[model samples]
Target: MAEEQEGSDAGSEEVLLTPAQLIRSLEQAWMNEKFAPELLESKSEVVECVVEQLEHMEENLKRAKGGDLKVSIHRMEVERIRYVLSSYLRCRLRKIEKFFPHVLEKEKTRAEGDPSILSPEEFAFAKEYMANTETHFRNVALKHMPPNLQKVDLLKAVTKPNLDSFVFLRVKERQENILVEPETDEQREYVIDLDEDSQHLIRYKTIAPLVASGAVQLI
Candidate 1:
């Protein structure tokens, strides 16, 4: 019988998923976040589940012989998972630091029932980052400026992600009628069907919705 792992969705519904499936989800989320130009929605559930698994494995390892080959293998596996988890989080933090103002604005203005793009902890980090950034700006340059020019608009100052940038991705689900924009005046926009398991190099903006819906995976 297949083992069941406890998990939850954004809607707070409890779901059963295998450990392997959970890791695959994390890997997909990591890759998508790594390649996407802009920040994507938070996968806190997967992160938490993976962290919990790591803790359980560490606890089990504590009971095993230190030099056992099986122990060593498990240790290495744990390390690999930790690396992926850390890298995923670091990628997100880098994006958050790069675009904290816009991130905060999005969080603030999102509809009441909509899911948040940042986890609660990430939200806190973004707010703190914004505060420190503004303080640094004021002390380093804004304070020295004439009163009329002292005010700064962070949204205008910080550059947003280039949605038009090209990204490599593999289709996870068959999608029909994806619109591809023209490159030049002579070229015309056209629609194309994306077959499942097919890979393509395309503009991020053109398939961003697919990425959000898990219909495509960034390669």
Candidate 2:
């Protein structure tokens, strides 16, 4: 069992995760975010915890002898963790950039008290990117258009995530009676059960909720 430690966030209680557990959580988040058609909910808490763990590891490494085998192994482990963190964040940024208008629209209309899909920093980046995009459009194209045609509906123009796209996933928890919609009128919709540790390729829209709930993991 993993040990608990005091959470670093203000108003947060003890976090029930050890360093190993934190790394696993981060890796899971990274993989899910990387493959999902749409941006998933922020895993900022997990990211923060992992960063804290890495910092602690680095501080200890600073005290180790330079040529020690253990130090070299630890350094390699640190680099791998860093790569995962960087790749996870980069994937999110790419999604935000590609769908800034839609992203901002969702943020704007999010229900009060609902968890945000973006981290605070990510939210700020999305807003700034939206602003910059609009400004560039106005300067390069909108400015030359007639007043009636000057306004552009970004939500309509930008491509939204293809939620219907197929994704490969593994079930972490068993789920029964998942309704799978038919692809065509002649085909019949069916229900299926997802057993624990079972893998399948299915439409992302069909299992998006499960992914967000952590019941399933994308491969």
Expressed as tens digits, the lDDT of each residue in 1-219 for candidate 1 is 123333234455466667778778889989999999999988887898888888888999999988899999999999988999999999999999998999889889988766678999999999999999999999999999999999899999998888999999999899999999997899999999999999999999999999988999999
Model 1: CA > 4 A from native = 1-12
Query: Which 10 consecutive positions of candidate 2 have the poorest summed lDDT?
Result: 1-10
What TM-score number comes out for model 1? 0.91
Cα RMSD of predicted structure 1: 2.7
Note the residue pairs that clash in candidate 2. Answer: none
TM-score of each: 0.91, 0.93
lDDT of 2 at 192: 97
lDDT of 1: 0.89
